[model samples]
Target: MIRLLSIFVLCSFSLNAKSISSNDLRSLYSKGQAHWPAIQTSDGRRVEPMSLLPVASPKPEHVALGDKLFHDVQLSRNNTVSCATCHERDKGFHDGRTTAIGIDDQVGTRNTPAIFGIDQWQSFFWDGRASTAEQQALMPIANPIEMDLDPKIALARVNKDKSYHAFNKSAFNSSTLTTEQMAKALVAFERTLAAPSSRYKTFLTQLNKNPQHAINSLSDSELNGLHLFRTKAKCMTCHNGPLLSDNQFHGTGLHYYGRRFEDKGRYDATQNPEHIGQFRTPSLLGLMQTFPWMHNGLFDDLAGIVALYNHGGVRPRPRKSQLNDPHFPKTTDLLIKLNLTKQEQADLVAFLRIL
Candidate 1:
C-alpha cells in the first residue's frame, strides 16, 4: 500500500539521514524513479523554471481518502458545501470568485487564493492566520461562513460513515476518525495539488542545455519580459526560490478598513500593530488560470496588477486606521513605481501566461 511504502521510505531516511538529502527524499519515495513530466538537470533531479520549484513527492494513501472527503459535501451542515467548493481542481484549485461564497450564501471578505505547494510554506492563509496547513484545515470547517460545522460534528459525521472507517484505519491506525487524523489527511492531500508542468518550464530546461538556441523557444517579447521580471520588475525578490514565494506578509496599501468590506489582513492574526494591512505574498504559479487578483480581488486582470506596481501604491496611506493608530504604516517599498512602458507590460503578461 502507498501508506506502508511511504512510511518505509521515511523510516529509511531516518535510519540513514546522512546518506539521503531532502532532495533525495522525493525520488526515494517514488521508489527511486519518477517521470515528472518535465525536463531535468544533468544530475537527474528535475527542474520546472516556470515555478522553479521541484514537484512534490508521491501522495500517501490518506491523500486519496482526503481527496474523497474534499469533494464530499457531508462535511457541511446542509450537506451542500465542501473544501472543493472553494479550492476546486478545474479552475486551478480555486473557485475563481472575488470572494469565497460559503454555506448559506455567505461571502468572505478576501479572495480565495488558489491552493498549491503550501507544504513548503512557512505559514498558511492570506493573512498568515495558521502556521501550518493542518491548522489551517481545521479553521474553515468551523467558520460560520464556510462549512459551518463544529469540530465535534465533523468528526462525528466521519465516525458514522462506514466507508471512512478504512481510511481512518489506514491513515490514523484507528477505527474512528479523530481531529488530528482528519487534519493530517487533508494536509497530505493538499501537498499533492501542485502546479502542472508548462511550456515555460520546457523552455527553461532547454535554455539550461543550449542557451543560444533555447532563446528561440519563447518569443523575443517573452524573453524580454523574463528579463524585465528579474531586473526592472525585480519580482524575484519576493517571488523567488523553488516555490516562487518568500512566504512573507506584505502591505500593498490596499487597506479597506471602513469600506463595504474591511479586512485587517495579518494584523488580525498577530496584532503586532506593524502587521495592520500586511498580507502573505501569494505564489505566481497559476496566475494565468486564476484571476481577479489581489486580496480584495478588485483587479480583474494581471495587467491591472502590473499597472498597480508600475504606478506604485494605488491609494495613499489610509487617512486613518480602524485599529485607531495615528500615522498608519506605509506600504512596502517594493511597490515603488516602476515606470514601465506599455509594450513592456504586455511583454510581462505574455511571460506570465506561459507559466
Candidate 2:
C-alpha cells in the first residue's frame, strides 16, 4: 500500500511540472517571440528606442518669463504686435492666414507653422535655415516687417517695467538683461512645448506596452486610417516616427500662383543644386488648427492639399526629384492619380486632423 501511494504522488508531481512548463511556453509565444510589436520606422529601419531619448523638463522661472515675453506687446517696436499676435495660443500658436501679416500690415511670404511639438524638430523655418529654436526665436523679433525691434531696444523696454524687473531679479539674479538671455529663456520655454497626451500618443503608449493590447485598443476607423496612412497614402514615408516628420526637405512641385519663384528653399543654405525648390517637411501635429498649407501658403484648405498629393504631387515627372519621392507614391506612375475615392479622401483628411 505504501509503495503504491508513493508512485501516485510522484506521478502527480510530474504532471504539475509539465503543466507549468506548457503554460510558460504559451505565455512567451503569445507575448514575446511570435508577437512582434508595431514599431515606427525611418528608411525601412526601426526608429531609436524611446527609452534612449532624454526626458524633457522645464524650469518654472523660464516658463513664467516665457509666458510674459510671449504675450507682451512691448517686445514689438510699435507695441502693437507680440509673438502671440502671429502665434496665438488659442489657435495652436499659429495665426490662421494664408500668409502671416505683421506689425505694419506687412505680409510675410510663408504661413506661420504651429509651434507645438517644435522642440522635436531638428531644424526650423520652411527652408530650414535656422538649426535651433533659440536662433529661430530671434528672427521674428528682428524681422523688418515682423516685430521690427532692435534686440537692445526690446531688452530696454522690458527692463523699464517694474514687474519685469522683479521677475528678472528673481530669475536671473541681475537687474540688467540682454537679448541672448531673453532668447535662451524663450527657447527653454519652447522646449517644454510638447503634446504627449493626444489619443494617438495614448495608442502608441499602449502599443509599446503590448502589441496585441494596442491592436485591440484601436477603433475600426482608426485602424483603417492607420493602414491607409502606412500603405496606400504613403504618409509614413515622410511623416514617420513619434514626432511625425522625417526632418527632411522635399519639393512637391508646388506652383505658387502658377509660377515658381526664387524661394530656392534648402538650396540657398546648402548651395546644393539638387536641393532647389525643396522645403523642410513640416510636422502634421495640430493640423486642425494650422492651415493655409505649404511653404508659400498657396493652398487655403486641407482638401486642396490632399487633392494635390492625390495627383502624385503638383507636377509629376518621369524621373523623381530628390525630395519628391517621400511625399508621392512610388508604385504609381500616373501624375496625381491616386484613384482615392471621395470617402477615402475624407477619411484621410479626418485622420490628419486627428494628428
Q: Which candidate wins on lDDT?
A: 1
Writing each residue's lDDT as its tens digit, candidate 1 over 1-355 gives 0010000000000122224443443333233112221221212322233334556664477897788778878889899899999987888888888789999999888788887876678998889989988899889899899999997898899889999878878777787987887887887788888665566667656655655455566675676565556545656556655666667787766766556555678988988878877888777666666766677666666666666566654455454443565536556665555666788778777877776
RMSD of 1: 12.7
**Per-residue lDDT over 1-355 for candidate 2, one digit per residue giving the tens place of the 0 to 100 score:** 0010000000001112122333342343246213422432223444322221134676778777877888888988999998888887677678888779999899987778777665678999888889988789888888888999987788898888887876677668777567877887787677666552355655566666675565555444455444445545656556665566668777655423113433656766787766666778776665656765667665555555666566555553434343544333122121234555565566566555555
Model 1, residue 156: what's the lDDT? 93
Best by TM-score: 1
Q: Which stretches of candidate 2 lie over 4 Å from their true place?
A: 1-55, 196-198, 205-219, 255-262, 268-272, 300-304, 316-346
Report how far residue 117 has shifted in candidate 2, in Å. Answer: 2.7
Q: What is the C-alpha lDDT of each candidate?
A: 0.67, 0.60
